[model samples]
Target: MSEGAFKKYGKRTLVYLFLILMSIISVFPLYWCFISSCNNTQQILGGRMVPSTHLIENLKNLFAQQDVLNAFKNSVINTVLVLVLSLAICSIAGYGFEIFHDKGKDAVMAVIMMSMMVPFVAILVPLFQMFTKMGFVNKYIGYILPSLSTPFLIMLFRNNARTFPKEVLEAARVDGLSEFGIFVRMFVPMMRPTFAAAATITFMNTWNAYLWPKVVLQTPDSITMPMLVANLLSGYVVDYGVVMAGVTICTLPTVIVFFILQKSFTEAVAGAVK
Candidate 1:
């Protein structure tokens, strides 16, 4: 090979090596979590990465606590409800903003984007008071309602909707199809990739939600997985094995969902970017 070609190949090889190293570093924590979950109490406390014989014991302990199952169920319901409602509302609003243009609507979209700039912590006190006034504290609705209209999801949908062919929309209009009919029949099917991406992200966020749920949900029965994990970690003795087992259980659903939707999710993002 020529010297210049050899030099370029060498630089590419170095870049590949650097990326591989970074990937390993990024994935190490998850690997450790899994290993620690399967380890014995001694191994976990000792900070060893290898698995131990206490896997069965940890699993048994995790299942023996009845509250864990209840918490899991509550979390699943809350996550699913939040994902469904949030996606539906955000997607529709996004599509509307994109397809039905008006100066007033543009101002409204600007306001929605500005709302994303406000930190949740800044609004928590007011939100808590409002929920309390409405007697929504400790209710599933309290957890799901505030999140049902995410600005990010709306933005995502809007961007994806831009990819929809204007010709198709115009043709539908010529066919005497109403705006709503065009959106439902043509735009919705074309945006499956975007929906899949949105679903994956929204589901994971809702599933792993900690702060809001912790504040709103007062009872054990109403608590979600992250809240339960926080409570587990806060116990006086802090049994690492038990905590690992709970973490494993709590992480499984999101991981499974990601694996299932990963292809479509990637395609969705790519399509949106295009």
Candidate 2:
């Protein structure tokens, strides 16, 4: 090979090596968790790296010792509701902010974005008191209410919306399509990647949420997966295997969602900056 070609190939090889190293670093904790879940407590304490045959045994212990099914059900319900509702509300808000021309819209968006700077903890106590008065404590509504819309998500959609084809909107309008119809039929399909990105972010955030849910969900029956895992660690005698099992279960859904939407998520995030 020519010297320049060899140099180019050498750089590509170095880049691949760097990426592989980073991938292993990123995935090692998940690998450890999965493997530990499949081993006995003794094996885990011994720093076992390989999978063992005790996975079913650990899972059975996990279910027997904890309300795995109930927690799983609650988490699924809360995550699904939050994901669906948040996406609908935020996407529409985003679409409107970008698609509809209004002199005051930018000011409204700036105010919304400013809210992101306020720590959630600042409102936690007040929100709890208000929810208590409203009788939403320990309810799914309490779980779903706080996350129904976020400024970052709205901004995500708005940025992507700016890239949407105005020509299509004009054509649809000329054909007698209403604004809602244009958004529903045309904007949604065109912005699928952004929606996928938003969905993945929302699902992951809602699923793995611990603090707000822990505070609002006062009843034992309303516990979520993160709460369940926290319970495992809270006991005086923590079982390594069972704890790992609980963590694996808790991590599974987000991992699945990310892998499924990873391509679109990447595309949408990259496009947002442009």
Candidate 3:
């Protein structure tokens, strides 16, 4: 090869190496968790890496100690509801902010973006009080409702909405379609990639929510998988094997969701870059 071509190849090689290193660093903890979960308590304590025959035993122990199945069910329900409702609300809000020619729309969008800067803890007390008054304490609504007005998700949708084709809206209007009908039929189908990315993100966040769920869901039955994982460690004594098993189980659904949506997610990202 020419010297310049060799130099270009070397740069590409370095980039690939750097990406591989980063990938290993990111995935190592999850790999360790899975391997550790397969081992017995003694094996885990001894830092065993190779798979052991005790995985079934550890799984049994996990189920015996934590009602993880019930928590998993609750997580699935809460995540699905939040994902559907948030996408609908945020996407519509985004469409309005994008299509409608309102003078104050940009200011409203800025205010919404600024709301995301406030720390969740700062509003915890007021949020708790509001939830109490609204009668959402210890209910699924408590878990689902708090996530509906996600400014970040709305911002994501709005940014994606800017890339939407305007001619379709004009054509739909000429066809005598209502504004809502135009959005529902034309805009939504075209924005599938954006929706997929948003769904993956929102589902993961809802599924993994711990602190707010723990605070509002006072009842044992209302608890989620993350809460169940936290409950695994009692004061001093911690069961390493069962905890690892529980974590692995908790992580599975998010991984599945990502894989399912990965194509659209990648397209959305690439489109944004373009």
Candidate 4:
């Protein structure tokens, strides 16, 4: 073979080898968790990696808890609500900031971005006090409100929106559509990939939210899935098998959503603004 051809083959081979190694590293934890979830705490403590005969028993114990299924449902509801509300708010904010342009909006966006640097824990005390005064303690709304439009997501949408074609928007206005109509009818359809990307991220963030939910939700009836998983180990003797099963179950929805939006994610994240 020619030297150039051999060099090309060697580079491609190295890239593939690196990718395979990274894939294994990323997936090994989930694989181990699945294996561990199928065994009892004693077997897990013994460092077993292979699947055992206790899978059904582990699942039974996880679901037999009264709060498990309810928390799962609450998680679904909160995730869906956050997904819908966050997409609407962030998409509009992004489009307006990028397409419309204003000094005041720019200043406001800067402030919002700066706020992200402050740790959520720093604001938890004030937020809890405000929620208590407003009677949002132990409420689903409390779980869904704090993250309605995250700064990182807003910036993501804005950057993506900047790539949107200006000519089409002007043409829509020439056709006598109002500003809101132009946004809803013209911009939204063209930004389907962006919306899909936003929905996937917002849903995952909401589904996996734990610290805030645990802090504000004082009652079992309103607790979320992550909170429930955490509560599993509150007793003197922790059950590793049940906790791993709960973790596996908690991981499925995010995985499913990512798979469903995989193509959209790639397409939306690609390209840059002119």
Backbone Cα, N, C clashes tallied per candidate:
0, 0, 0, 0
State in Å the error of residue 213, model 3: 1.0
Q: For residues 101-172, write the lDDT of model 4, one tens digit per residue.
A: 789889988898898899999999999999999988888788888998788777878888777888998898
What do the candidate models score in CA lDDT, each in turn?
A: 0.85, 0.91, 0.85, 0.84
Task: Please provide, for model 1 over 28-132, each residue's C-alpha lDDT reduced to its tens digit, 9 standing for 90 to 100.
Answer: 887788888888777877789787778788878776753788898898899889888898899999999988869998999999999999999999999999999
Q: Which runs in model 1 stand beyond 4 Å of their true positions?
A: 1-13, 263-274
TM-score of each: 0.90, 0.92, 0.89, 0.88
In model 2, where do residues sit more than 4 Å from their true spots? 1-19, 268-273
Candidate 3 global TM-score: 0.89
Which residue pairs show backbone clashes in model 1?
A: none
lDDT, residue 54, candidate 4: 86
Evaluated against the true structure, the overall lDDT of model 4 is 0.84
> Largest lDDT belongs to which candidate?
2
Global Cα lDDT for candidate 3: 0.85
**Model 2 Cα shift for residue 219 (angstroms):** 1.1
